[model samples]
Target: MAHDDSVLIESGLQVLKRYASRGETLSYDDLHRELGDPFKGADVAVQVGKLCDDITVQHSKATGLNLMISVLVRDSETGLPGEGFFQLAARLGRLPSTGDADAKRAFVLEQEHRVFMVFRPVKADTSGFAPNH
Candidate 1:
């Protein structure tokens, strides 16, 4: 399988950029809702994670070390990304395979701050998601 949902990837990137512009974080459910709730069944979260991971991979390639996808968390209270985020971060060598909780939280916070800095309206990438650079 190609595993390439380009439409969802494009749409999800827009949603992330929208939230990042406001220096805001969104729940996985929020992303799902914003993406037209295309996913169904128990794997919706997993599917969403895949979408975020895909966007992160492309965004990283385009912008270098920009894991801006940190804006998507399991929920706002926890304010932490799901295991999938950590997994991808590790796989990309951005973080250790099993970093301590504080370390992981710190990484996400830092990335979110960077996302806000780069994607905020004043400094937004007007070229749209993926940047094409």
Candidate 2:
């Protein structure tokens, strides 16, 4: 039987949420491994984008916070393509968005095999969040 798109998306969400909760990065290889058959023959990027949208909506309704997921791909070795790194971020509803800055930082940290940091926004303070790495 063919798996439903919702099933695939839910599976992806579960993996993403787990990593997000731990402040860990998810690589393309990791996602492919965990997602298994559901991800087969699907446009992985589109699926991830959908997953991000779902996460944003669910997170917003549940916590009144904004959720962002970023994906980064780069060259692993001098002549080889690298895998993608996925990162998540949560921010207060009132703060001006820093856009992809935090995501980029998280990607860099993941590339270095360092700790992934989430810079959560604080009320009445906009000086910039701390680096968790």
Candidate 3:
């Protein structure tokens, strides 16, 4: 990314954590609103989506958990992640790129719920990194 990825990842993680605690989801607009300087563009949705992916990858790498935090960030209207999430997931072999809407929606919910379950209060790691149970 042209911007500071670490900063965006940090901010995006904070926001995703808050939403996960509430068992809720947020849109890219909601995420970008709290993130630091926005990327130079007419719309920052693409930027926020990339940040979400980065957060998921970084946190998973750090925690050794396969759950994705990006699932918590979605479109407010459709209540699902943007195409970028599915595209990345497909590239990662998490989902089929040609999956239908229902299948995609199901995948998103499954991941989102998994994210919430993992982030819930637990007696695991307290290293202030990834949440654990």
Top candidate when judged by lDDT against the true structure? 3
Candidate 1 residue 44 C-alpha distance from true site, Å:
0.9
Report the C-alpha displacement of residue 24, candidate 2, in angstroms: 1.2
Candidate order by decreasing TM-score: 1, 3, 2
- Clashes in model 2: which pairs? none
Write the residue-wise lDDT of candidate 1 on 63-91 in tens digits. Answer: 77657575555555677888888988888
Question: How well does candidate 2 match the true structure in TM-score terms?
Answer: 0.41
* Model 3 bad stretches (over 4 Å): 1-4, 122-133
Worst 10-residue lDDT window for candidate 2 reads 78-87
Of the two candidates 1 and 2, the one with more favorable TM-score, higher being better, is 1
Q: Name the 10 consecutive residues with the lowest summed lDDT in model 3.
A: 1-10
Error of 1 at 102 (Å): 0.5
Q: Give me the runs in candidate 1 sitting further than 4 Å from their true place.
A: 123-133
